[model samples]
Target: MSIAICIAAACLGAVLLLPACALARSATAAPASGIPATGVIGIEEGQLNADYWIRQQSKPDATILDPRAIAAQNKRLHELDASVHDIEHLPARLTRAQVREWIEAMSQPREETLYDERGEEIPAATLAALGDNLALDTIPAEQATRYGMVVRRADLRTFPTRLRVFNAKGDSDIDRFQESALFPGTPVAIVHASKDGKYWFVVSPLYAAWVEKDRIAEGAKAAIFDYTRKTPYLVVTGASARTVHTPEQPGVSDVQLEMGVRVPLLADWPSDKPVNGQHHYASHVIELPYRDDQGRLQFSPALLPRAADTSADYLPLTQANLVRQGFKFFGERYGWGHSYNTRDCSGFVSEIYRSFGVQLPRNTRDQAVSPAYNRIDLAEGLSHEERLKIVKTLEVGDLIYIPGHVMMVVGHEDGWPYVIHDTTGITFRDRTGELARVHLNGVSVTPLVPLLFNREQPTVDRITSIQRIRP
Candidate 1:
């Protein structure tokens, strides 16, 4: 069976970890009866494939934004969005109040009841303990910001502790602690340490959260920035790729590189020399960051196989490329805050656009309100018909937002728009106009019109905004 079929079958009855078997049936077999057996209610035969959407576009290959245009857009984002921090230009010193605000903003107590993995209610005292671990009292009056580089793909947590919490009991897919993830070679400004000294509150370009200290290596500011700006880098274009597994250099071995992660290439390396026991001939020698025993930054050459999905630079921002990139993550499990080595809905869209050098805020709330793009705001007063009219005009790569989730428009089929998104589940009106819920806890493609945000409202009516990554 194909990977999608396996994923779909394995995910049956799961609340938030995999796709439903209905997806498998839709991809593979037709019903024995004369009627077509599309397991998904609205998905048609060819709709599962990315090529179908690409074929529908009149100018699929046309560049929506060239590199120069993308660079301009990124510049505008930094200037407009408070969330998209310009860490490089950040001052070396920060006030205690500034650091406390950043910590309190992310460490606020949850409003909803939370449960542990064992189905036990997480008590108020436990939540208080987690808050105490923030070590806000230890912030110096005049804090010095330290620079570091992410040595590996590391999880960014809402709290310093690794305790996993969930919205519902026995549903272990979405861990509430996971805020986001930082890829290798990414620069961060280390500001505060957790009370236990195991995690650091570092601010990256797109996110600010508590990441494990060992995953970051302290280094000089110049060296860190220079490494980021190094020429002839490789941009991970696939959903994800890993370095060659090496027993010799355990730190750099088998490191996962997610889509849009750029690593500087060691172009001048000697071809005869081996990198971490592997010959350099069949691989691209790239510079990777690793934390030494003393927790300092060090760069070493590592071999990424030539066959790995990577580009010399960012892909051209075009309609076809957008559809293709979105499909690369077609069956990936939904990972909240970039957990599980996968991405959440906003992260999925962010990474897709990042592969083309487009910058986006890390979270759905921020991305929806960001002023960097051409946005069509659907106010609460707008009628469902009015929202549907806007949805019809949505082209490939347009982002549709409703509260905490976002979806990327792929194409339209018979005037009903389709979207590819990372979601836990979707409720929609089935053929009989009755509500049907499908637990699709993965990256999936589905039509837009029939989806419901809740029992009383359709997804279109809930749309807060639609952002187009164009001039």
Candidate 2:
């Protein structure tokens, strides 16, 4: 007879850490259903499916200017935590939470705040507040003022309209500007926006004022805001060209450029943007955008051709067994062109459906607009009843999308809807358990939302529409 194998490390460790004979009690604890012993966790395993499990070995501490360094620090913390957990099993009588506390204390390092341009660290209070699950959109006004990062040119997208630039860094005050007056695709910075949907910006140093809600993309990722703290005054010359350069050094005074395109600084240059002619000068200028080892302007394949799956069966109802098969390929680091290392959005969808013998389109937009086996035209819009009818008509394994994206609604896990899609990797987002957007580099699966599904210019926002396809 075959044995249903179970790994005892997670349970045994938990039991031994409790106390004498406490092992017996902990040993009797069966993990919640559907949760397999992943060696790191013993609880119902379904909870472990969240796209990156960040174990808080240390107590939440300060805000970091460069959060990138945390990964290196976390490695040491994990090692120390293992040692702490090793001793807790001595029958010393501790609650489970207590055991976890001690383990965390040993594993995590004390939080440290990173300093700003002035060489002073942000306040501990500010760091602690940042630790809270604060939505990017609901930032408190006081904190916004205190931590306000000033950037020159930021890209903003108005819902259902073309993306435009707003001059958030006004040459003067911002009380005199008008939203309607702001030019499309013009760069702007965030001075202030209220939860009530009212806000103000500086179109130029001389112009500033309130803009309507429809004028700004709510909670959009502010690229310029991120750069201002590090590299200030990065100017670009070619207004119509795709490639631009960055200043070599920080705090360099602006150089005279051209018009129809302000030589003004641009922020959040794409990973693939050209760097030639971009120079940085703290006091003196230095050329950059160096050639690669092969003597070519550095280039990497950011997007691949979209392919469609051509498998035979694609219905979840006909393939119910996949519900229990979690894409357990977690803890993998991200890599470009290497889907095996980290899953991209289209890569995840294509591979998963392939496993089930269902062919799917390889790119988000293509998959979203593929010859549907149903179509939901958002242009005409639909009532709740109509929407439900359309949704109800969907078969298991049928894909749902916004404009140029796709998501697979799987069987419920622990009373919540589980969706499988490609994020930076194959990650899961748990909203109401049922509805979640595929968030990768700030893009998701919600319809009517603007997405960077296609990298080509001019035709970028053209989603066309959404489609539902199944075999």
Model 2 CA lDDT for position 262: 18
lDDT, candidate 2, at 348:
46
Reference-based lDDT, each prediction? 0.82, 0.28
- Residue 277 in model 1: lDDT: 83
- Give the C-alpha lDDT of model 1: 0.82
Candidate 2 lDDT, 368-392, residue by residue in tens: 5444224555443444344434444
Candidate number with greatest lDDT: 1
